[model samples]
Target chain A: MFEVENLTKKYDGFTLDGVSFKIERGYITGFIGANGAGKSTTLRSMLGVIKPDSGKVRAFGLDFEKNEQEIKNRIAFSSGAFDYYSHERADRVAKYYSNFFAKWDNEKYEHYKKVFSLDGKKKVRDFSAGMKVKFSLALALSHGAELFVFDEPTSGLDPIARDEMLTIFQDIVADGQKSVLYSTHITSDLDKCADYILFIHEGKIILDGTKEDIISEHTIVYGEKEQAATVKEKAIGIKENAYSFSALMKKSDAHSLSLTQEIPNLEDIMVYYSKGGKR
Target chain B: MSKNLKRRGTLCAILKKELFLATPLPFYLFALLGLMTAIPSYPIIVGIGYVALAIFNSDGFRRSNRDVEFTCTLPVERKDVVTSKTIFVVVIELLTLVFGVVGALLSVFLSSPNGNVVGLDPNLTFFGVAFSCFGVFNICYIPGYFKTGYKSGIPVLKGTIALLLVYSLVETAVNVVPRFNVIFDSLWGDFVFARAIVLVVGVIAYIILTVVANRIAQKRFEKVSL
Candidate 1:
């Protein structure tokens, strides 16, 4: 339902050059990138919060510029940093938000408030960072949004909160009418919650596809230096530790059973690709 | 309808947030009116009361909140958010005018002996000036709001410094030439025209600032990562 096409933005020190991606109506798309990789810029352009220097963004098949308000009603977002209204209590903030958003579900807000065990009367600024992230998620979900765009939602949370958030995200996408674009440095979260992974590096998308397609299409190989000759020119980075070495190869070219071993993880592949498939 | 058009509630949500931020200004209006009504002179009381209304609302334009970052994320257009805030300032101006006039009229009625003649026309000048003051507030505020979400030190600091410079310039001009006031009084008949000019300038400036502010908001919002 969301399409970001050839989006470009420029700053004095950084640039997001012709980035493009699409999120299907129901799948969770994880935007994985390192710091300064333009992931956030892509998200902002998609939301039309920042106008791309060039190219068009279509949400629900309508141009974002022409139909910004209409499209916004069905979308919710939580920022990378877990900040909230410092002076207002959590319940008060929720109530204030309810007045403007007709779709806001008070019951859902209340339910999540309880689930997260947030004290309704406490000012948001008093809450810990993890608590703030939970509150932000609860608020986003309570709005009954069709799309959830989270910018590093798991940044400051404890492990338990992170696990709980992942569970909540999985449940959120179960309805199939809902979609998400989760941008984060946490590779593990993508493994658990994302269906499609888009890897951004140096302001461009290096690789993007379903988890299985990426993992299945790539294989990890290891042995002596002579085996490197048999591998494709694009070896996805090699690790050398004293006596042995390991390298990743395209699975289509390398027979898995014949290869020394296979290691599959989003992080390994990202590191492999970012290093220009060197081995 | 396009999917985006089908889901347009985000703008209202943004306006709601702005309204909460602005609601406290009206209380200042009431307090200023109460203080002014206690004064014995009707015309003077009325004129100053109107000025107080403008000033009270101006105070609301003083600070900026960084929390605007949160609001910018919801699916609302930046223009809509700017429009909502502009509408909010207009509402505050109107409410202040109503309260100032009522308070002035009541003080005149209560304190005057046997319905003595008192000039109510000058109060219209007061209204004009107050309206202009509200206009100035908006002009300064809207642009500032977009630049820093009122949180960063730059926009507000610049506004404050500019306002102080303007205030000093006006004060200096008023002190320098008695001839200027006499000439001004002849044209405006005791500052009515001056207040009217200010009111008009304020409004024109407000409109121009709003358009600029709207564009700035759109740009800033799009650049916002979250």
Candidate 2:
């Protein structure tokens, strides 16, 4: 239930050019992008952490500016690099935030503390990186939020910790009422958890769709000189080999052109699309 | 919700955060220092009290990039956020006055006035100096909150330099011109009364400046990109 309309933000070195998107309720949406792709910028604007140069961000059918407090109360956000008040014990921080958030569930926080194996009495600075990430997620989850926005939530976690995180996310989405916007470079996690993928490049959303539609509906073409001519010039980039070429075109076109094979996986598609492949 | 209540809630949040970090250390240090000094130079002691309050309250403004980003994510309005910070400084100023008196009392007891220590009016003079220092602290302290994203290092350095320069200039002028004491004498019969007037006037000036800073801080925070 989030909509970003004609969101334009200009900076000295980068510009988010009127990017627009809608996140359906009851689905995990992955904001996928490489470094410096403006994914963090877009997420920040959505959370009202930073003001956009122009345009509107609507959450839960309300303008962010008008219903900021209400929207914030219903949503929880966490990032991998984000830190808790370091000198504060996790328990102390929880106590402090209990007043700020109306729906802060003390039972849920206790449950998470055990599940994450975090000592609530220990200062946050004493926790390991994985522990810190888990602590942040615990805080977000304990707030009884309807929507969770995670920015690279599993970046620094160990493999086991990352798996645990994914499991928690899966459990969160099982109710079919909650939603999440998970921004991460980890496509594998998205493949396991995200229902929708929005690929941001520079500042524009270059690709947006469900995982199946994004991967299965498209085809990557690789062939010799003759096959290169079969593809449209505008859609093709430089020919890598004398008798070999690769291009991205519709799968339907593949049947018409007698194509070779379909390159599956989100990563390949992202690489192909980012490197000037078009359809 | 009433706007005033909301503002107060926001202010409470900021004050709580600051108190958690710095309530006992620097705040109590002043009391300790005052006890050690034993109330000899009332004016200097009051000035120290003011600076201590200002510095302690000002710590909240120093934040790393991550802290700023996290804080901005809270639901509070930008104006309320800025106002809450200003309120925090004011609360510290008020607390400083209370502690300042306690310090003065300790100072008076420990000094055990000797014959050489003459012309030291312990009653009115001590309270007046302490109160005036609090007022001066308010005047100098509130403006820094308007700075970008609660940063204080620049403000702290600049404020210190400015205060020193002003003090030096005033001292030089009063010394170079023999009739300056005559002008001062006409202003107030004694130092205590003059300091009291300064305290009152400074507080009034501080309130006005706080309103201005609140407006500017609110406007600036609103435009700040996350």
Interface RMSD (Å), every candidate:
3.6, 2.6
TM-score of chain B of 2: 0.61
Model 2 C-alpha lDDT per residue in residues B1-226, reported as the tens digit of each score: 7756755665566456545532435543444433322355333343444454356443652353244556566656666656666665556555555555565556545554341132223333334434444444444444553445656666555555554544445445544676643333122254556655645664565566556656666776777775
For candidate 1, write residues A189-224 as lDDT tens digits: 888878999999888987788988988888788777
- Candidate 1 regions with alpha-carbon error over 4 angstroms: A225-232, A256-259, A277-279, B1-15, B21-65, B87-141, B144-226
**What are the TM-scores, per candidate, against the unseen true structure?**
0.75, 0.84
Model 1: lDDT of residue A101: 60
Tens-digit per-residue lDDT, B39-84, candidate 1 = 4434333433343344334434433234445556655555566676
Residue A114 local lDDT, model 2: 94
lDDT of 2 at A136: 82
Q: Give the best candidate by lDDT.
A: 2
Q: What share of the true interface contacts does each candidate keep?
A: 0.52, 0.38
